[model samples]
Target: MKLLLFEDKLRENFFPLTLTRFTGDLRCGALKLRQRLEALLTDDEVSFLIDSSIEDLYSERHPDWQINLIKPGDKLFVNCLLKYSPTLFDKIQTLDHEQALVQGNALVAYRSNKDHGSFDPDSVLKQFGISTENVDDALYKHPADLVHDNGRMITYDFDNFFSDKDNSFETEPGATILNPYNVWLGEGVELKPGVVIDASDGPVIIDNDALLMHNSVVIGPAYIGKNSIIKVAAKIYENCSIGPVCKVGGELEACIIQAYTNKQHDGFLGHSYLGEWVNLGADTNNSDLKNTYKNVVMHSYNDRPPFDTNTMFMGCIIGDHTKLGINSTINTGCVVGTGSNLWGRDLISGYIPEFSWGEASLLQPYRIDAFLSTAQLVKQRRQLKLSNKERSLYTSIYHRYQENQ
Candidate 1:
């Protein structure tokens, strides 16, 4: 049997990430969701059926293939699955609709309503019927899920602790692997002496070049992205995905920091997803939940009608190159657009437009000087200067959105 991973309606929900690849290319657990599905149905040949609109997204990544369509008298069967769970896949069945076998039983079908909406992280939550408390709930079923649940621990083992297991490590002298069950160290990684890693229950993944400084207590199911650093005395919690080349410290939990973002401060950030090139100031705190446990709503640049996320624990979805002020407090379900230079004491509304320069109130145009300065900092951090073409592209975006000011 042949299975098709068709991209029909979930296109918008997987933007930016999907902007570079197909939805089947997305990675959640140790394996890509689509790969897991293929493994489960090993007897079948699987192929992706990408929509024409998203075809360009995969042009450079995957080779072209003939996509099958349901037609009259076709004995084909199709199943729509969610990246979050395999149970959702099992619930699907094929039904004959008109002359074709329609792939139905989707928990959320593609809304044929002319008012089909655009993508926003929080809005996707409402469509999926997800509550913020359950944001990482599906991921909890991963082998690493239990590792992120209880958090990591640090205990001194005077004797040398050695692991015969492949991909295991014993860092410098005096460092201990108190709870090995919760910690999963990737290949070719090392640790220095006096370094402490705690894996009480949740799984901790120290990816390649992920350095744990002396006495750092990193909790489980927490991913220190490839080549990132955890400074001395850092505290990292579960449900965290720190992407490549980041330098982190203090505390973090249930957060997704895309590549090249930094939280190198003594602050608290929970239940958030930071885009590329973002920098958090020292002592920055974001409210993940309200005092009242009502559903969270998020507004975005491309979305209309404030949408419900059905989640009480939704935090912020910041765009690229946005910086937060020292002691800055972001509202729940806040969506800060790209190239925003936010600084000040006032707590602004959740939706801050792109290229905005402001102090929480009385915001204005972020002049070129400020934009270039931050851009330069990002360039230096990433070890690559922005090309003139890239600069021109950003300039175009800035001018286009300048009217929003």
Candidate 2:
């Protein structure tokens, strides 16, 4: 059977994170949603059906993968937003042809034989005679959900993928590890002197080429991705996932940081989800809990007021290509949009629109030319070029935001 992962209409719920990529690409634990699915369904031919807006960019990044290609055979279409679980996996394995598994209003998966050009859940249901099967499996309704479930996912990924006994690397003197059996150190991992890894609570998996510098402390369940650096005296709390090529320091608690980001200064980032290419300036801190300890309310891309998250701990959700100024303070449950530059000592709060300039009180639309120029420079620093496709996408988003205003 062929496996096709598809992003549905609720993609906007993820906002700025989903602005540049697909929902399946978002990282929660050691692996991305797509990677987890691919690993579980290894026997099947896998493909994707993503939004048209990011098709070119996605194709450019992954040229080998198939997108929106439906072959004439038994096909299993799974929702990219569905959280991975043993029950979900077993149910998917038992799915019969022309069966649609759903959870409330959300589509979980569909098994079909007819090859249609459009493969959205709604389109598939409309075109074929399918029997609906309701499921209780959870779906990721917001970005904050990833943060809430990070620790559990980390433990799950570790037990399933890295439970083998392999002690290949050596740690420097003064580097200590607690619950050594629960820790997995990948190839070329460097644990400098005075580094302490405490996995008494849960497992810790440091990927290949990752460096934990002097005096750094990491508690589990946590995942430090490939080539990431934990700076000197850094304290990484449990339930944190730092993606590949990142440089992080200070204190991080229950956060999901995407690839190529930097938070390498002394700051406290808690319960936050940061997108790629983001840089948190020195002393940048966010308040996860409110003064009253009430549930945090966050702004969404949908047409509605800020809604309660039902959780007291909710930090900022920063979009890709955004940079925070030194000593910038982010308020609880703040949502900062893509391509924005925030500076000054003021408290960055509320919903910041895309490509915004200036501080929280007086945000202005960032000039497209200036944004693009800086973006090009940022990419160049990483030895990558800002291609015409990216420029065109950014420009269109800028115009769309302006037209709406």
Candidate 3:
């Protein structure tokens, strides 16, 4: 059977993160949701159906499949945004076309054949003669939902990652491994001396090509993704997901740092989600827990009421390509949008709009030309080119932000 991942209305709500990649591409555990799904369904053929705005980009990333191709066979359509339980794949494999698995109002997974030509989700229910059943699964519809549940998700992924495995990677002498039973290592990983890994509380995974510099301390349940680097003396606490190709340092806890970002200095980043291509300058920090310990509230577009995130540890949600200046402070529950360059001495709070500049209480819109030029340079530094599709995506998001204001 073939597996196809599809996005839903939640795509738009993802905003700054989905501005570049789809919901399936968002990194939560040690792996991207797409990667985890692929790993779980290793024997089946898999592909993605994402937003049209970034279709070409996603296609280029996965050129083996076509965006519109719905093959002539039995297919399983899976919602890309659902936080899948690794063990659920075993149950999913046992089911037949007689039943459909859904979570709440969202139709998460269903089966149909070539006789059903339409790829639209609404068509699947009517086309297939299957029955629907409500299944309890975590459905993520908003961006902050990632930050709220990342720790638990990371731990879950860790268990699925190494429950039946041994130390598959190499470690250097003098590298201390506490509770070795809970540590999972990937091939080609190098741990320098003076590094300590404490896995007693939960599982720890260091994926392939991840390097831990001397004196770094990694505590579980934590994840260091492929090609990522943990700089000297970095304190990575429980429940953090550091994605591929990132450079991390200082302290991080219960946070999700997406791919290609750099936080390689003394900084305190906790309970946050940093999108791709982000750069946190030296000594940057954010307030996660409030002094009063009240619930954190986040305001976004669409004139909705302030979202009361019942959690007390919600940090910043920084969008893609945004840069924070050295020593810049982000207040609790702040939402900074895509392509913004924040540089100043004051602490940032509340909602900062897309492509914005200047400092706290003195904000100004960043010009289009300046934003593009900097974006081009940033991509170049990472050996990537800013294509017309990316430029169009940025333009569309900029206008949407303007309209929301």
Question: Between candidates 2 and 3, which one is better according to TM-score?
Answer: 2
Tens-digit lDDT string for candidate 2 (1-405): 889999998788898899888999998888898888888875778889999999998888789989878888888888988898888888888889888888887788888887667776766655547888788845788888889999999999999999775655578999999989899999899999999999999999999999999999999999999999999999999999999999999999999998999999999999999998899999999999999999999997757667677899999999989998999999999999889999987899988888999887878889999999999998899899998888988887788774465
Pairs that collide, model 3? none
Cα lDDT, all candidates: 0.56, 0.89, 0.81
How far is each candidate from the true structure, as Cα RMSD in Å? 8.9, 1.3, 2.6
The sequence of per-residue lDDT tens digits that candidate 3 reaches over residues 1-405 is 888888876676676778778888888877777777777764677767777878877677667865756777878777787776655665566667756677766777776664545467655565446788777754676666777667677777777766755654457988999888788888789999999999888788888889999999999888898999999999999888899899999999888998889999998998999998899999999999899999888865566777777788888888998988999999998988888888899789998888888887788877767888898998898798988878877888777775456
Cα lDDT, model 3, residue 347: 85
lDDT of 1 by residue, 205-232 (tens): 6777778777777765566667888877
Compute the lDDT for candidate 3.
Answer: 0.81
Q: Give me the overall lDDT of model 1.
A: 0.56
TM-score of each: 0.68, 0.97, 0.90
Weakest 10 consecutive residues of candidate 3 by summed lDDT: 114-123
TM-score pick, better of 1 and 3: 3
Q: Please report the candidate that would top lDDT against the real structure.
A: 2
The total number of steric clashes, by the backbone 3 Å criterion, in model 2 comes to 0
